[model samples]
Target: MTQPSFGVIGLAVMGENLALNVESRGFPVAVYNRTAEKTKTFMAERAQGKNVTDTYTVEEFVKALAPPRKILVMVKAGKPVDAVISQLKPLLQEGDMIIDGGNSLYEDTQRRTEELEAVGLGFMGMGVSGGEEGALLGPSLMPGGTPEAYDKVESIVTKIAAQVDDGPCVTYIGPGGAGHYVKMVHNGIEYGDMQLIAEAYDLLKNALGLNHEQLSEVFAQWNQTEELNSFLIEISAEIFKKIDPETDRPLVDVILDSAGQKGTGRWTVVSSLELGIPIPTIYAAVNARVISSFKEERVAAKEQLAGPSGKYEGDVQSFIDKVRDALYCSKMCSYAQGMALMGKASEEFGFNLNLSEIARIWKGGCIIRAGFLDKIKAAFKENPKLPNLLLAPEFKQTILDRQEAWREVLAVSNQLGIPVPAFSASLDYFDSYRRDRLPQNLTQAQRDFFGAHTYERVDKPRGEFFHTEWMENS
Candidate 1:
């Protein structure tokens, strides 16, 4: 039999779907799982009449693929990844490539790449986004590896990636885990986007007294607009329309309030802190999830927490307009933060990431895919060294125009005892960014007094640190 063009290990839904996708695109694929039965069952059911081979062992799986083989591992991240790599190392020849499509940490990818390269094997740490359906159809593919390794697999990856007006959503990210790093930030932005949408839903439901139907209609209208058009917005509208079969209510109403996360958002925040990058909006979104997870504590605290308990008597249409504006403005800030973090990471990690390309690929398939990303792409294309998305003329002007409504929504939410942390943080980030001067001088003075940490003065030139004798001179 002819050798398969590609191999996929780990027969979970993601792995199986991706293998099917490869085969559908006319590439013969070999598949394997730790449980041999899974490989057999998947091939029998999903791979029937397709160019697919099922292998019962690692050696058999490796041998089934063509030389200088391209193998994708979709198993769990961390130790399982190491275990699989260990198992594959003995069976694979030199020059064969291993692509990790899991949500592994970028640092881990870097280490694994070096380890594999030492043995004359190539490693690609790739980030595959757009969930299960996207896997079965197309996903945004971010692969980081040597140029030679990338060249070998680029054709297949591009073919399996979601297509946009410009091109496919797959690109060769920089070497040594840059792909996973970008995906980590992508997930961070996803968290921020979802939280902002949730806050808008809460405000619309509580402040405007809108039912699920009205909420769905509102989101549907917003999704039609250029600024708020996104996959998350589109799905949220659909979510609001879903009815619970047993409860006879909106599915969202029957669902629990507690949110569950799988760590990418938290990883993004940790990376930001380590990089000394301010991603306040994304951090706030992660914090919102953490707070949501304390469902029992929140339920208990609500009885004792006292705040305003009255209905919003404002004009409902006007309030809805303001909330929509607020949501868009906050969404822009969240993207701004995520992009700025990526910029810092690129410089720090020597990734030489093409920000415009990243934005272009992100315009489709990814969770954070949005119409606004086209604008971001344009901003970066206009100036590759653009400091932040908020500094772009178009974005800056829009935020300025929407600031009043944004502030008004925040004020109203606070007065009515609703917590809109992500929205609030976005506004604060905007305010902080535009300020020429801040109260940090007082903070510096306090630090100096407590720990003799010197301070720089506005009256003097920069780099001239001043120390005060507070006890004697004061």
Candidate 2:
């Protein structure tokens, strides 16, 4: 039997599909699961007649691999990951590598990498995006580890990763959990994108009084535009057109309103707060999901709350265009926030992340894939030290041109009693970012007055602090 070049632990959907992907790319793979029956079933069902070897025991799985083994772990994040690593640590030899392809907290990845390296073993925290189908086909891959570790698995991963005209959607994403950190921010941006789309749909349906068909048409048209072309918008158009066979109604209408999250979005917000970076758009999106989970409270509040009682009474087409512009503007702000957070994280954590490379790879396979990512890539390329996406000339001009329409959409939504928290938050973020002078002076004075915290003087040199006695030292 030919020695398998790669080994995979866990027989879940992601693991199974990724193993198959490697096998299909002409590399022999060894697969294993804790349960022997699952491995037996996988070989009988999915791996039959393929270049895949199935092993039941941890020893067999380890022995089946060739020297300098490359293993990919696709189990659940956190404790399950630690357990698997613990089992494999004693069995694995020097120079062998373990890659974690789960959505783990970056700090955990950092710890794992440090622990494994001390014993002459290679560890990488590689983030695989694009879900199950992407695993079988190709997905965007973010690998962070030593260059030596990346070189060992580079041939296999690059061959299996989603390819675009720019290059394969996989790269060495710096070291020490940089890959996972980027993936976390990616999920956070995805949350913001989804919330923004939902708000656009809500405004169109409730405010403009569009039915399912018209709503579908609106999203379909928006998808054709370069500015709004995205996987989320593309699928949203399809979602609106889906019919529930049992009820014979729009599938979306039949579905529950409460949304669920799997912690990455919340983690992004927490990281932003700790870094003192303002990601209001992403924060609002996470908050919106939390609020959505309180379906009963929202339902009860609907009856108790009193506000404006009529639909939008304006030009429908004009308002539709404004909503589109507003959505695009807000979407840019969300991306800006995420990118800025990564920039700050890179500085604080010593993760020399290539922002351009990250944006370029994200152009395909990932949920956030879009034409807009190309613009981002170019923006970073043009100015590698670009502080914010909003400051890029192209983005700046587009937002300036569209600010009026953005304002008008919010005004209309407010008038029609529609809650566009993500939209509103994004606009405020944009407004705040672009402003040279804000009302933080009063905030500083209030803080000083209450807590004796010193305030910086604008008239003096930067970083000069002053403490004023309010009420004449009384």
Candidate 3:
């Protein structure tokens, strides 16, 4: 007999599909939605045989499950998660398991886990990715909670996850909030990554004057390259190839440049700033979105500031090639920034994370899933504290070998007044690395000399900080 599985709370598109996925994988599931009517509606739909089943509200949801039940919560992050937990507490018995499958903040997950653990309830904060389709067809799963709790749920998650030959789309990341924290960071990285692709599209459309089919071909070919291969890259081809019948122009040209962004992109930029990671491309992406919001203002600015705009002149292929390099470089910056946040979170949360495993799981399961994910998995498996993603050997080699090409691309784009945000950032990071000594250190020294701020000793042993060095140097 199939074990009874219940998915509590959100029964939106992702949750509904996931329930279907679980049922398809041979588990009988009872689903609950916040609105009692939604549950009834779901059951009625299932009765009509339209993608739903065993639907119930909070009370019926609890009663339908067996003792020591396994219930997964799929609600909006923050207050909604807490609200559902509060309402469900009275109905749940001791030893029941609840998994948070939403995009909640990690610290909140950790706090909630401890709170639930005090009452003998087991908690798992899981990060589910691959969107609605992946949810139904086997999305990537990251679960963090008690090892024992994960062990109890592992088989269920694994069986329903996407398979890449042998590996499942699921893994137990760490203890406490690690799962959700990883997920939050995962979303953050996704924001930057999508933005870079958009920038690439914009560059191709505006600067290179490539038609939809040609641009689509470029992206399609890029998907085959290990350096730029990703689902995003692959999809870029389709987005470009889309054509509008009314005007007979590529659909991309008609789409508004001022695209809407969810909170994740803004959160990524904010989090990166807090973590002190350089993420110029991600920042550019965020800014670009913001700029889009002021469509009228921009139009006004266009009229007010209009003058001679620089014309992009050069080998179109060569410029395209350079833009590709820039995209990689900016992508590295965003990855580095996102990882830096994880490092800080790890220190704060007391969970030892495995970056390699993070990379491995992301390779095929998440939106950010891509060929380079394998490189990250390898790099972190070798050196966990890695300060920058670019320091990852493959990335290092890519930047070093193709750096000239990237710089050339940025140069040509600038010459033509093409605003290549990611491209510009890639060149900046590369040029900064090429220098033997950073002038920022000199500026820091000057700041310390005047402000009496603390400074690190150059001559002292490693990992030492010294304020007296200022006195000696001055």
Candidate 4:
């Protein structure tokens, strides 16, 4: 079997591992990075015998690959990408495929695609997840661009993409920026899912006053359930239960309570706000991270603060059950926000995307992979345009059966003042969005004040418009 020609343009851990993965998949990888030292180092470490050549120059790098090549750009998302693209602009010939395999902004991807198209070059904005290892083996690949370019590269991508026992790891998400946009939402949902786990951990720690092993035991039990089974859940129990031999206590305690968030978490919150999708859980999760960063603030407030915070004692199982519900509901809200974003992007970008396929592909490998994915896969299969996760028969039934338990948890958490921000935010978004009238809709008024953005009237165009006294007087 002849190995197809491909080059990796970055040699970071992610890039290096990915190159090796491509090699493992039987495609000889030609890797080049901005730093010659790193490339030389990587070549020295691995490139031996008759298998490959490590080129020192862009021209040499381009020549090392077969014609009509597949060159994947895996550099840092922004300026580094532009610089590399500019360098390759002259080196790449007509009909070569350039894939951006970083966490790039989708809009920028669109702009670059248009620019590259003018030069007879093809572009694919890809979203690669599963981190370094995922890249080394097979990460879920979301490729968006001209179908011709995708088809040109699909042979290798399909052969190497990550999978469950069944579903494929790759999808030609749509044309233009659709792939990256889908990926952006994938990160957003990831934020929601992780935060939900954090909230559950908090509830268990607080309500039961559980120690590390106890909390670990709690998560382990949660994983036994079908709804919560996932990579995040499984590994998190490990994180909780890990003990320090010297300290004889859980490592999580010594670890700071602060959660470090990469930009994707914040991007999910901001983009959802722009699109008018209520992703309160994702937002609150981001906000929680921001608050976590306030180590000094807590200290400062302590010296100037008034009274001590209250404590609580309740049925711990009842508390756990409710926290579970809130997490599930928040999970639902985040998924809804993600699907909504996809729907909007699909319409706005003129792309035909299979949301069910997206769900099916997400089932096993990625951070958000869970049993819930199957329900989403089934729901969308039943109705591709299913309004939300909650509307799906299985999910709707799950929520309905559990709502009584969930409400009690929310009620107690509210009483306890344990800062159930993400959980409550999701519940609030759910109840209010379902409601016909939401008070304090200053967003409409503010929009009008700035751009003279006319509000739609409820009587006409849903009669959603608010009449200003100044406009009436004028």
Q: What are the models' TM-scores?
A: 0.98, 0.98, 0.89, 0.91
Give per-residue lDDT, candidate 3, residue 397. 82
Candidate 1 displacement at residue 248 in angstroms: 0.7
Q: Order the numbered candidates by lDDT, best leading.
A: 2, 1, 4, 3
Error of 3 at 175 (Å): 1.7
Residue 432 in model 2: lDDT: 87
Superposition error at 469 for model 3 (Å): 14
Ranking by TM-score: 1, 2, 4, 3
Against the unseen true structure, what C-alpha lDDT does each candidate score?
0.92, 0.93, 0.77, 0.79
Put down candidate 1 lDDT per residue, 138-227, tens digits, no spaces.
999899978888998988999999999999998888989899999999999999999999999999998778999999999999999999
Model 2 alpha-carbon drift over 4 Å, by segment: none
Give the candidate number with the greatest lDDT: 2
lDDT of each residue in 1-474, candidate 2, tens digit only? 678969999989999999999999999999999989989999999999999998988899999998799999999999999999999999999999999999999999999999999999999999899988889999999998888899999999999999999999999998889989999999999999999999999999999889999999999999999999988899999999999999999999998999999999999999999999999999999999999999998899999998985788879999999999999999999999999999999999999988999999998888889889999999999998999999999999999999999999999888878899999999999888778999999999999999989999878999889998897966
Residue pairs with colliding backbones in model 3 are 312-416
Weakest lDDT window of 10 consecutive positions for candidate 4: 305-314
- What clash pairs does model 2 have? none
Of candidate 1, the 10-residue stretch with the lowest lDDT total is: 305-314
